[model samples]
Target: MGTRLRLTAVATAVSAVVLVAASVLVLALFQRQVTDNADDLATSRAEDLAALAAAGRLPDLLTDIGDDSVGQVIGPDGSVLAASASLGAAPAVTDRLGSEDPVRIDLDGVPDDDETEDYRAWLVTAQGPDGPVTAVVGTSREAIREDVLALGLALLVAMPLVLLAAAALLWFLLGRTLRPVEDAHLRQRTFVADAAHELQSPLASYRTQLEVAQRQDDPAGWRAVVSDLLAETDRMERLVRDLLFLARQDSSASAMSLVDLDDVVLEEVARVRPTTAVDVDVTGVSAAPVRGNRDDLARLVRNLLANAVRHASARVQVACRQDATGSLLVVEDDGPGVDPGLRDAVFERFRRGDPARGHAAGTGLGLSIVRAVADRHGGTVRVADGGGGARFEVRLPRV
Candidate 1:
């Protein structure tokens, strides 16, 4: 079943149980009140009959005894001396009756029919003019049963309507609550598809190069093909590492510590200098501290430096410092700066405003990684204007 239907079923079952419990409680309370009333009436009737008989006078005990009420005066020998007209010549319901406590009795075959009756009755023994006699009074339980059945029927009619309304309201609210998650899932699917398509380019190149190398008979041609193949493999490895780092940062946001921005910048610049001839200048450094994962922040700096080194005409400058707002890092190169309109677009995955930097220059994920790292650290990166070339500025909250 769908979520809505499943939730509705669960809610309906719970509401049904609650309704049933409430109905049973109400029924019990009503039954108790009716029983108490019946017992009091029966006991009062039995006491009045005993008092009249003991006074040696037969008053109006015969008055209004037809209200489903039965009373009888038993002689000292368990023989009936006086009784309501409805119970003519009937013996005591119980054989051993002495106290005036109320008792429940089931009257079956009272009128010689295939039916049974229920009653609450009280019995007492009192001194009479003739001798000790037993006084008994009782009333039928038909009225209590009728009220209880009526209540049950009313609940049976109303419960379904209440449950349906509640289910409908919950379905609407839950749909509204999960909409953002649904949108994110769709976006993730699209991202995966885009990533797969991007990855296919390098793999197809490797296959074509290898297939050609197998057919080429010249040793120099095979060697050249092998070198180009290794370059493509390096590109794929970098792409994989970038994807993994982004995924890890996405999954682990709380694993962050205080990071020194100046150290991160100087370290990346030094690493790049040993591998390339680009003149990387480091100038801005004055207590640029922030909170972030050390490895991820290092990766971010490396990407920025790599991007600069790949595209810089001659020199790349790395700057880091803390300001009143936050920590700032800027990587500027003297190559052709990006188009003003394409600055934001370059930070998207697989986006390369300077694809001329070649396959070996870097994966197009450099700026995207920079942006992702900044975002993970509760910071932001944007392409800001430089003096001559592109300047990528990063700002992160200070520790």
Candidate 2:
């Protein structure tokens, strides 16, 4: 199972165990409390009955004890003198050991079918007309059993529902908590596959070129081979650099300082203007200060430029402006812009606009890096809408 599910299961199990233990403890205490109260009441009433027998008024007070009670007054010879209506003329409930303090004992009568009875008795020796008599006060345990049974029933019925509700809540919460982890896992898988694909072509080309050069053994041929090797190495190095940059971003933050968007854009424009046939426009550019790492902001501009330089048919516009909201950097190309449907997909890692026409020997991570920098700086990057060509825009908050 996944980490989230395992954690939730453990939590649920612990909660259930604790809850069950607490319920058992509560039920046991309830039983003890009820039984203790019953014993106390029975012993007190037995004392009253013994007092009446000693005063020679036992008969008058005999009916005073409730019918639910079973009482008997016995002479020292173990013969009954008086008894409650519930146990009329019954023999002594227990052998009254000559003790002043009350003694408790269990009393069972003839079993009725398979059902048993709830009987608990208390015996005490008190002063009587016949030297000394024993008073037995026995009570049914039905009240205590009923109360305990009700609690047991409640626990049995409610525990499952409580656990089910807790499980359902945990399922939802764990899903929400692990959603980002799942996304990152999928992203890592995709990244590894795409990185391997990008590196494979360069390694294979290097191998084939080296083999070709070895067969010829010509000085001129080896030079050309070395040159090609260098270009391929450069390409691989750039890809590795981009990948490392992204990895580092996940681990820590870069130093931040105020930066001018115009300066960064102008520098990137100057660096690329000579390499492309596309006509570049910088008339719309302006200075807009913001807080960010200069290197990352510069890379963001370079990637946008590289993207435009590779795809634009004739013209690419680099524009910058500042507003109440933030600073905006807009790059527009005069080629067939990104398909509106694929606009969002274009910024994803390892995504390509056109493998045949626009890959441009450049890594597919260029736009992804643009978006990452924008995000790291608490900014946003998006495709601007203007109908004809692709318009990419980056918005960064001011310092």
Candidate 3:
């Protein structure tokens, strides 16, 4: 069965066992309390009757006894002298009698009753007008039985409902707890598949070029094949490097320190200026300090600059400044802006925008890496309209 079902079943079974044990314990205690209370009441009544009999003040009918109880004062000859109204004209409730200590007996019913009702009787002996006599008192057991039966029925009805509720709550909490894990597992699978697909292209091209170079007898033709092989090798190397960087991002525990965000931005811009004809504007740059791994932050800045330079029509603008919330960095390119539908998807690994936006030379992982670095630094990145082209913004917390 599924994990949630298994967990719920185990938890419910434990609850059922505990409930059963607790119910049995409570029932046993209740039965004992009820039985003890009845015995004490019967004993007290018998003692009072025995005192009256000793004083030679016994009457023909006993008084002050409960309606469900029976009392009898028996003579030495076993003849009933005084009896409670419930047992009118009946013989002694019990023949056993003791003088030093009270005798207790369980009987079906009194002599005159037709129905077999349960009773607890206490017998005590005392001196009477003629000689020694006995005082017997019996209390009905129906009330105690009724009380116990009511409690048992209540628990029988409530236990299932309680278990059902507990199971439902447990299932809901387990689902909530496992959702993120399931999502991460799905993402990992997708990432592996995409990485394999991306690598297969370069590998196939490299093998084809090697085979072609093996057959080429002309030195110039061999040179052409070697160049093609080198280009494919370079492509594969870049893809591998990007993949390794992403893998490390998942498990890296890099230390953090105070770094100037604007300085990183300026350095990346200066490095890229020599490689591209796109104009790199640094006029908007300002000192923006943040606390994070300096190398990762530089990578973030580098990726953003490279993406802009790769797509920009002629000029690329870079800006960095401290804001009320934290540090804000923006990069805008004047090339065809990202399609509105693919803006969010661009940050996803291996995701590329429309071909019209010139993604031919890009690895598609640069934007993904930019997002990963921003996220690792407890920041956010988003794409917006840069007036004429796409604007990428990165926000990080201030030191």
Best by lDDT: 3
**For residues 11-55, what per-residue lDDT tens digits would candidate 2 score against the true structure?**
899879988999999999999998898888889988888887788
Instruction: Give the per-residue lDDT of model 1 (tens digit) for 176-250.
Output: 876666655655675577569778998899888888888876778988998898888887888888776656555
Superposed by TM-score, candidate 1 places the C-alpha of residue 338 at a distance from the truth, in angstroms, of 6.0
11 Cα displacement, candidate 1 (Å): 8.0
Task: List model 3 lDDT by residue over 338-388, tens digit each.
Answer: 888888998988777666787567678999999989989999999987777
What lDDT does candidate 1 reach at residue 354?
53
Query: What order do candidates take by TM-score, descending?
Result: 3, 2, 1
TM-score preference between candidates 1 and 3, better one: 3
Where does candidate 1 have its weakest 10-residue lDDT segment? 105-114
Worst 10 residues of 3 by lDDT: 107-116
Off by over 4 Å in 2: 10-23, 51-69, 73-83, 110-116, 124-134, 169-188, 255-258, 274-277, 354-357, 397-399
Pairs of residues at least 3 apart in sequence or in different chains that clash in candidate 2:
337-390
